[model samples]
Target: MKYKVCGRLGKNLKAGWLALVLSVLPAFVVADEPPEDPAHAHDPANVWFIGRGGQLYDSWMATTMAEKPWGNHPAYPAIGNKRGYPTWRCKECHGWDYKGKDGAYRYGAHRTDIKGVRGVLGMEPAEIQKIIMNETHAFTEDQLPHSAVEMLSYFLSFEQIDMDKYIDRRTKKALGDFDEGAHAYQSVCALCHGYDGKKINFASQKYPSYVGSVCARNPWQALHKIRYGQPGTGMVALSNVDLGIVVDILSYCQTLPEE
Candidate 1:
């Protein structure tokens, strides 16, 4: 039976069977080994880390689980206080567009006359880290872990997008298809923000800040959040999706009630 299985005459059967066995051996060995995880699963080279870094930049205090800096920032006197953790937010001074005084916050309640980090683009990540820890910035390693700082640096260095391309800063309108955006919003955003995007009151009722308010008032910030998600929240980042979808969602959100 073994000789017949080898498909050879009696004398050559052993050699033929040996050749067959040798050829098939590697297959069994490969099958015994566990399969590797998907390439997207926790890959160090994945751009998702950059998105997380963007989230950290949006609200380091929230991302790092660190206490907000006590009192106002040294430069806060010129900017006025709005109270709460927002005062300590990096975007509070830098502006969501990263244009700081040169951009959206140039003359708003968030104005601080501070230069944006736009100049810092393409800078060495290490240099950005040093600036973050510098006395002027005064971010302590204790407050923000090295990893978190590195992530923030990565975001500033690589993930800062040009809002001018996707939004009309003057009109505060998203440059996307409204119907497409509405569909995207109803699919996922409506779960927390509601069909009208007013289910969640990110700000006080008197102030009446909602998704629409954010989209209309600070489109840059809204775009950043939509791309990277809010820190320390269940809000999912849409970084992996086509950015046009994000712009579309922003357009739909703009149609919601702002006040």
Candidate 2:
């Protein structure tokens, strides 16, 4: 017997095929999405959330949408007030380098004579959480939610990098291949910071703080920003990039004009 194709049957078959394709499309789309970075896979929170914690470390008041701690930070008189708003920032006292008075802020205007967070580098996240809530830090749940606290704690516990490996403290320079860094900068950073590395002046035009300025003045801060990105900005973290490449990028950035 010869089989004939019916119009109605053909239409039904077509509809069935369309429905099948639609059902399986999502799986393919999800498969194409990038996987979480393994570097942070062991952390209590995802890298992005931990990055938010880093933002909190920079300015908890800004990150949590809470008021700044009232009055001098209690330690203010000893550390001085040259840093202004940063005087209230964790980075101000501990240093953006995360080494506190023992490192970057050891003798500068940011000097506080306080110990660095390095001592707690590998502490448990939960333990770090308690430290923040303690009388010294005095952060309450009302100001920083449990989630925020967790993220911050996780960051402090696991995210601090050793600056000595990537930066030379004596010269305040990146310890990487400048040529390689120049290429990386041209490929990825030039789009935003421009060839001169002055497309964005993070500080006022009068002082004109560019990528070069940041690298020259604080290679540690530049390295941190390069690794994790500037919080709450369009800045993309080079977390996936090799640390050596990042060091190279920093080295190139140091060549830019500071003023």
Candidate 3:
């Protein structure tokens, strides 16, 4: 899909802000310069996060679909209904699950016309971010603040994930050895998620089997949370954990009953 600016930053800005804007986007000239720094995870100008944020920004913001290129922009901004494209928020279309309607927002007005960013699994964070920042992608430099870019840096640098190797699509189980994953789960998740893998009650309306259910419905969602961590939840991303170990955990999760 062609990338177009849906919105621009507010006019009220200081010299630094204006400079940042210019540096982020120059008129007419499409420069494919790599990010300025690779080590700096907190700077938008950093190669790692900006690139990741760019992809993420694009995933939620840009439209490639020929049927609905706009991909259901929010007619109103308010959660229930306000004005000016309420659906513009990333959370609106993709749902908190990031698996799009296939996950949490499967039903409701927020239910939209596409899938989620979970397909980004296995891609390098920088590569993923590049897709987000591309003109035809979700985020435009003019549309977001430096902090937002930085936050994307944090996500791409620290949060975004790659799940392809971890899950077994055929058997719907994890594929790696489990020693480290066991240790991590016992240390961090056993109390709430439980040793039996049933504490989360994902099957019930009140609770769901975090592991079992996610694997059955969409393993990609599980992989994303494992990497980036869930928003507003106590769960944290496991960037330090080896992907092999994560696969072990998923393997175990696939063993659980769906109901």
Candidate 4:
């Protein structure tokens, strides 16, 4: 679908997160925040907790460079369809929407009765960290280091967004300002992604997953990568910026060349 600034999201449909996030940005340029010194984690610019945390959620194996777990996850149901490494991914059971059976994975091949991570949206990071290391989750010290778990917990506590609040579940469209979106992309993303967003092919030679292609297909996943840097790749992140700016970037991305 062709991207438009004032499309299906409607002028009256501005999300509160957009305004809320913009408030945190330094003159609307989140990337221009404080220097990369050994700063605190809460600092938006220094923080990779959100990005790396979410990346670990997407695939701990890739982000940690750890071996992908073989066979089904112990918690994964026997009735589920997938096998091997993929089943161990947090998104496999909980879903890209973080709403597991209750969300987009409710009825697909990825479907499982397992609940989503949304339950811990506002919980303390320490509490969530325990849950990750708990027997039910069964992540041992050897598998996931303390730092990795801490980052993942921080992401669960403060960084996760209610994607439904931003993108239309049906149309997968986002509300954004054209000029703002263009400026945001050119100022930051264009350096790596290049103008037209064709600098990289993330998927494969046959499918050719370019920036536009990803946004076009599974925008929820695209938004996740946009907010949190790509798994194990130094892809720039807007994890600390508000959801509005990122969605604006996404709306612009939808217009890129998919091939």
lDDT of each: 0.79, 0.78, 0.51, 0.79
Candidates in order, TM-scores: namely: 0.77, 0.77, 0.48, 0.78
- Candidate 3 vs candidate 4: the lDDT winner is 4
Backbone clashes in model 1, listed as residue pairs: none
Per-residue lDDT of model 3, residues 1-259, tens digit only: 9754333433344555878888877632432212333455444344333333434433323322112233334232234331333355555555544556465555656565456666654345566556655664355455554455454544533434333345554564566655656666667767767775677774567655556677566665566555545543565545455556666665555555555
What value does the lDDT take at residue 86 in candidate 4?
A: 90
| lDDT of candidate 4 over 127-209, digit per residue (tens) | 88999998877767866999888888877766676778777888877666557788898898988988988888887888787
Could you tell which candidate, 2 or 4, scores higher by lDDT? 4
Can you list the residue pairs that collide in candidate 4? 21-242
TM-score of model 3 relative to the true fold?
A: 0.48
Please provide, for model 1 over 53-117, each residue's C-alpha lDDT reduced to its tens digit, 9 standing for 90 to 100: 78877888887678877766655545554665576678887888888888888886777888888
Error of 1 at 170 (Å): 1.2
Clashing residue pair totals per candidate (backbone < 3 A): 0, 0, 28, 1
Evaluate model 1: give its TM-score: 0.77
Off by over 4 Å in 4: 1-41, 44-46
